[model samples]
Target: MAMSSTCAQLCLRCRGFLGSKTSTRLHYIQSHHWRIWTANSKSLSNGLFTNGSFTSTQTRQRLKQHMCYYNNLTVKYLTTEAKENKNADDTVRSTDGANLPQMPNTTALSIPENMNSLDLDAFNEPSALEEISDEEAVTIPFPTIPPSSTSLRDYVGKSETLTNLVQLGVDLWKLEQRPNVGSMLLRLDFSTDVAPRLLFLKNIGVEDSRLGYIISHNPFILTEELENLQTRVNYLVSKKFSTETVASMVSKAPYLLNFDVKRLDNRLGFYQHQLKLSASNTRNIIARLPRLLCGSLEPVKENLKVYEIELGFKLNEIQHMVIAVPKMLTAKKQKLTRIFDFLHNTMKVPHHLITKFPQVFNTNLLRLKERHLFLEYLGKAQYDPTLPNFISLDRLVSLPDETFCTEMALATLEDLYLFQKTL
Candidate 1:
């Protein structure tokens, strides 16, 4: 190989790594190749002598009296060719290291004195991927996300049964109602407990993508008996709900199938007879709000009573309110009562107007109160849209807070905030 002139110089700098630059050089004498240096300072003179390139006569005299320290302290090396000219007594080689000619533009490296010869040669790490094993990618143990990311993911790494479910995209966060589902999942056999339900749902026309979210939202659907689930579907069909409507209802509220067949029959009967909802209207309401059947029938009955007896709404107005917002049928009786009392006595909103725009039930009572009070504060509390300075009830709650403050309230958000704080 050829040699480069800029070699073996940088190792002499011996500063930090930043101060060091990459260099191509290697230098070695026969035996001093990896030798350690020691001082021969058994005897010492009283003082040390120095000079500034010996420009003055005193510097030359002092240099002449003492040793040539600069030349003595500097290391001197013989090149490969020069070693042949040197006496054999000055050159030596150890049998342990390989004998190689001193080459230029190469780095000199030696194993440390304490390191074993085979240790350096044998230290190799396996090159396999650490995040996931190939076998896990294919089978009942998928790579898991952190527990903090979603509730059941941590269990996936440890529970073989859960790994496949997570792989299928079941979002465990929606299972907030089942706090111990992670441990409970370990006991279920996915092939028997879950796979049949998945097939049944798909056969019933539930979309494939919604399977995971529906199962997570209502975990009981998976554990529910296949026979029972099919019976509920059949009952809906018996009631003239289409196959598409049944599947749509399941997707919207998975717990709809979890209800007992008799209880479901009673719910369907209540809508038909007691509430006097027409067959088409009942179907429309169920198709829109499927979870209306999830809870017991008592709350629905009580809210209907509150709308009629407690709030003094007529039969047609109640039916119109139900048709306008199906959710009001299942809303808490107390909440319905509070909204009615405030709108009736305080805001003086007419009962028929409340029935026509029953979506006002969706707004928070506190917000309704604050807006009404703020409008009164500004002396613009007129609600009847035909009257002067009328504010639309729809815009009051439907508009965003900032938009409502600017357009309807005619006040800044700061004023509303201060007014709410006082309330």
Candidate 2:
């Protein structure tokens, strides 16, 4: 009875101490104290200890173990609670009204049942990518001029000429299907001064489609003074170009009319005198390559230097080469050097033969190698120009595959086919 009273007093004291802690700690203390008391009672009832008194050291060891376990659990619980509280604080702070920006509500509005049934796929169907017409396409707006600007004013005395130019522009646009012809004419700042020159161009056989091409390409031709256009024409005629040729040149290259007469004369003189080409040859060259007259003479001069210094060609030989293949003068210096080296060193062809057949240099290097190697393999690679069996470089490279195989190589088609595969 006394021991029971003492146990009750100890339990009361434990409860009193635990009451000051959290509910979880109070519950743990009550459970642990009850377990210790029951164990002590069982030890007492079994007489496990010799003495009537409990061992204070054993009781203190058990208390220390329980305290250590409870302390670890309390520490774990406090850590979990601290983490949860921190998360809650962070969430609250992040959503604070002062820190957050106001966002618009973007909830979708409900669609009607009928609208839901519509085929939305029809809107995404592939459509033809038709070109936009000039009327539909956007263009830079024309510059606005004052109402009293000359472009807006009608020539009071030359109403007929104004009507003629407008009619001409409209008809020409219709024929060529050119857009913004009216706008372009306004931008050219057309006036009565350009009327007689247009008439003169028409009188000189530049009419209809030809005239349209000229005016469309060079609208300023209409603004050119009459004397300038006439002098250009007269200069061409003085060079013995027929009236037809002069008209054709002008229609093809209207800017030819804009070139200074002295500059044109200098270019022509270079072709005839420096290149040693006859007047007829010079005309033919100009007709064949109209751009030659348009470009500067520097390229021609540079090409001559390449021929003399690089290829070791005499002046007469260079003239012959240019006359035969005028484009060779325009060929890159590196390309010319490669071809010359291959011909002189690799093929062992004489320099005279190379100059005689300058077109050989223009032939593709791979094709040249294939043909020469195949012929060499057949022991028919004739290098001498005097030999009866000699193959001219032109005839060798220019011939069709079958003709070259049968006539030059004298091999069957199958043999040539197999040889080509090897190459």
Candidate 3:
């Protein structure tokens, strides 16, 4: 009897309920004085049901809803496909895969199987797609092609492409009103705002004799071609900068290029641009040099005085050569004679005599100045962080007289400013 009751309890626990069967079992026990209830028993057994049977009924109802949903979905898909097929047949369109549009045959591109979504023919002629107004096109963002495997050059050549190539060759090789290089530069400048990729090609590799060579060799030119012009120019300009002391003066500075004297020589690393100078510019430079000092045609004592002041702390071999200008400037203008006398006279002056007294005649004063000046000017010393620390010797030599003077003044100002910065 206890065993039967235990079985009934187990069944009720498994079913997650004890309401009806449990109550019947309790009534049978209280009124009829029976503790156990068998499954086959007449009274309480009829009210009981198994948990598994109830679970199966719930599962069947959920399955019915799912089946109904699947049928609806299948019917809808079939209806859409049938309508599309009917419309296609009415138009008499060929359903063969070969009839579908193909990707433009870019020279040689091996597309991967995973990129099946990409329409190769669409990339075949970029210009055709470009002609479609932006409003008509649907732009979908796609993943970038890996640099190692993808080649964009295949897509670039077209009928008009040859015309552009010929024009570029002519621009580089043929002469213009100014000169071939000048014409190329001017033509490139005009297209600067409209087509910057072309400008970047011209700007860099200025030293390369042929445009075609430059285009093929420079990775930057390739990248710039893919991007817009403004972005290309900004990047190219930044790349052209140098590590020298005068780097800042020439980089991103206004009117600075105009001041460069070596603009025409194309020798110094800096002389790619033309320094436009007038005849008047030449005259101004000759006038600015301290005139042949005195009636004797030699640099006067006054000229030496100014040299002493210019040297600031001390004089070196160059500065001492400058000091002997008086004796070197004799009546004749032979280059060797002038250089010789200048060196000879300064070496004759004794160092001890110059330092004993603060006066210019003190021989040691001049020699001591030479020693100090050599160390100070050995490298173009930077005085300010904002300006160039060094001036270019080659550039200074090539510059027109007036421009050279301007450069000197600028250098002097830079040196003074840097000195002040330290304080």
Candidate 4:
């Protein structure tokens, strides 16, 4: 009876020691049970408790039941906490919005047959962001959308500015009939802004229909200031570009009117002073190479250097060559080198003589090669260095196909045709 009383007292003390909180209760129970078991294990094993109301087996069984109950409680509490944490994580992911980076598609992560055998480390280098600076991080700008009208009629109804512009010379009916008119009108702004500029262009000899064509081709010209357009025209006139030539150039390359006067002056200077071309020749060059009016003269300058330094031509020789065939100045360096190599090293033509007949360089490389080789095969390639027939380079290259076959090659057309086919 005393032993039973003592066991009951111990059970009450153990229960009291464990707190009511579910989280800490399991921990306390585990620790306390271990201590109690370890301290009393030897006595229990020796059968000292045999005479007690509770046998050692019964005591161990009771302790085991308590431990199992606490363990089950702990598991249930942990499962409830895990469920709450998972809910929080899901809420965070959904609320992140655009801040969260996009994940790659699961399909994209599937390994290809060849890649499956390769070591993953080879492709798993650190992200470029780590190496780059904060300033270097690319800023993705929000797209900008220009204000748009639903339709021409709707646009005219809403903006009085656009209605007035249509009244002035912009053929709104024609513009409305065309596709993408909303975008075109938006770019042109209110017609009131463009009318004065159109009048300015008309005043400067751009005919009514011609002005329409210019506007159609390059509507942005309608936004240019009258004074700026007049300045470009005046600068062209000062360079001796005839009004007709200026009008033609402007009509064909309307962007020419947009260039700054200083830039126009610099290009004119390059043509007259550096290139040694007369005003008339400059106009002709511009007609042929329209881009010359706005593009950098650096390319022409570079070609001149190539002719002077690499090909060993004097300045006068280069000036004459450019005046004769301005397109030669724009030819690729490799092309010029190939022609020079053929004429100088292969044909044994002197550099001075080649410069004298720059037209020789304008001939097709294959034609030049075939004709020269055919002449050589016929044993008529060699000639006196001083005579007119003395390798008449221009005549050799510039002759038409029929003339070359009958006169120069001294062969019938059929024979030349057959020879070319074989080549």
Residue pairs in clash, model 1: 24-105, 25-106
Whole-model lDDT per candidate:
0.67, 0.65, 0.33, 0.66
Q: Highest lDDT, which number?
A: 1
Candidates sorted on lDDT, descending: 1, 4, 2, 3
Instruction: Flag regions of model 4 displaced more than 4 Å.
Output: 1-186, 189-219, 276-290, 382-385, 388-391
Ranking by TM-score: 1, 4, 2, 3
Residues 278-305, candidate 4: write the lDDT tens digits. 7787778876665576766677778878
For model 2, how does the per-residue alpha-carbon lDDT over 1-423 read when each residue is reduced to its tens digit?
A: 333354355445434423333343434544565576557655542323444565766655654554445444433433433455456666876787344322222123222233212232444444579566687566736534433332423332234433455555533344224454334455443455556766677777665567655665666576677888888778888999887777667767767777778978888888888788889988976765555666777877887898888778888888777778777766776778887888788889877888899898788877888888888889889978788689889988898888998999999878877887987
Write model 3 residue lDDT over 122-153, tens digit each, in one string.
Answer: 32354643566576556745444222212222
Worst 10 residues of 4 by lDDT: 111-120
lDDT of 1 at 344: 88
TM-score of 4: 0.50
Worst 10-residue lDDT window, candidate 2: 102-111
Backbone clash pairs for candidate 2 read none
Better of 2 and 4 by TM-score: 4
| Residue-pair clashes per candidate | 2, 0, 19, 2
User: Model 3: what TM-score?
Assistant: 0.20
